[model samples]
Target: MFVGCHVSIRNGYLGAAKTAFAIGANSFQYFPKNPRSMGVKAFDAKDAEACRRFAQERGLVSIGHTSYPTNLAVDEEDMRERTVKHLRNDLEIAEACGSLGVVVHFGHAKGGEPLEGYKRMIRLLDELLHDWRGEAKILLENNAGQGSRMGTTIEELVQVRSLLAAPDRVGFCLDTCHAFASGLWRGSNWKEVAAHMRSSGYFSSLAAVHLNDSVYPSGSFRDRHAPVGRGEIGLEAFSEFLQTPELAEVPIILETPAPAIGGHREEILLVRKLADRQEGVFDLEK
Candidate 1:
């Protein structure tokens, strides 16, 4: 898998690529504009050009994610509209940059029936793809089941994908921390977890991964992310990550806690080592 991180793009898009190189990454994900406000920030033509050149020079892959608030399943009319605008902008930028995927959260139901939230998501995505020219596929990310958020199960994601009549343009970004917290890590259930997702037609639907350890328990449904291999979801889940064929061609991005708290380096190194070793490992998740 291509390894990377969720990086800050406030300085400029090129900064994201540069930071990836520092971490020995050949791939990365970044926001095209303010993540909270949906305020658009057009990159300098030369800056965008420079970003491409620099990443190409180092053989790096750049990916884009929409603002955190851009939720397709949000019930609030204003937020949903805002979500649509920001996602459209992200798709535009990602396409312009020739990025592979545009990562996005499925979003909270905002107190209504959660399934309806997914229906809303499907409707919105249909609109986005109606005229989208970009090659970048939309990668819907799973939540930790925090609050009213959707996407805790492969069923939910598969439901969303199915709504689009199983379109190949849609994809998934499986967050490891959320995977554990959603109960997929129960008693060394990696194979079951993998099977569930695959049965949902995930083999081709997944486009990337959010590699994180949990600061919560198995099935916590909480949204706290810990450094990799330093929390409840331990090495076993990660060992499965390397062997999972669906992720073999996807980008794996770290969403670990801040470096000052420690384990940032250790986490990266651990995943790199484990993924490289492949085929044989103990039950670290148990």
Candidate 2:
């Protein structure tokens, strides 16, 4: 697996790459603009080119994460229109940056029938991909299944994708903490988990992974993320996850707490060690 962490984009996209390198990461995740607001800052094409060149030179990968409020499952016309506009912008930015994937949270159904939500998602994606030619694939991320959230299960995610009639531009992002909170697997039975995913035919659709530990117990339905090895999901479990053959070469992005609380550098190194035994690991210092 390609191990990395979420890097800040405060210094601009090129600076985000520099921070990733400082942390010993060959991959990273970043939001192109403010994640909470609909407003977006104009991107500098020169800077984007520079960032792309830097990544290519170092054999690095980057992923663009969609904003939190981007709800493609909205029923209202205004909200749905806004969602389409913003996500289309997201796709453009990701393509300009030469990102491999754009990770997005599939929105909640707002207490409506699950089929309705799926249909909404399908229509939104259809519009997004219609006459689209972009290098970055849209990756629908799994949720914690809290409240009216959808795409928590492999079946639901697969179902959503199936409606698209084999769109090559669509994929999935499996969040470890979300899976744990939703009680998919408690970091044990990972082999069975991998087998099930493969059997469901969704394994090949995985484009990225959010490597996080949960702050709460299993089945908490909470989305709080702890640093790797510092929460309920222990290091041993992560070790097993990294060694899973099916996830090979996938971009594993850490969405853990910032470096001050959990240390992004350390977490990236830990995951790297898990992924590559030839890297030579010493014991993790407390």
| TM-score of candidate 2 against the unseen true structure | 0.93
Task: Estimate every model's Cα lDDT from 0 to 1.
Answer: 0.74, 0.82
Question: What residue runs in model 1 are displaced by over 4 Å at the alpha carbon?
Answer: 76-78, 261-266, 278-286
- After superposition on all C-alphas, the RMSD of every candidate to the true structure, in Å, is 3.0, 2.3
Query: How many residue pairs clash per model?
Result: 0, 0
What TM-score would every model get versus the actual structure?
0.89, 0.93
lDDT per residue as tens, model 1, 1-286: 5777778876777777777788777778888777777865565667776787888788777778887667787667676666666777777777666577788877667775787877888877887677776678889888887787468778778777877843677888888888777776563788887787767787667778888888889888887888766787677667766777777677788888658644244456567777876543333444
Residue 191 C-alpha lDDT in model 2: 83
User: What lDDT score is found at residue 276 in candidate 2?
Assistant: 65
Top of the candidates by lDDT: 2
**Alpha carbon lDDT at 22, candidate 2:** 78
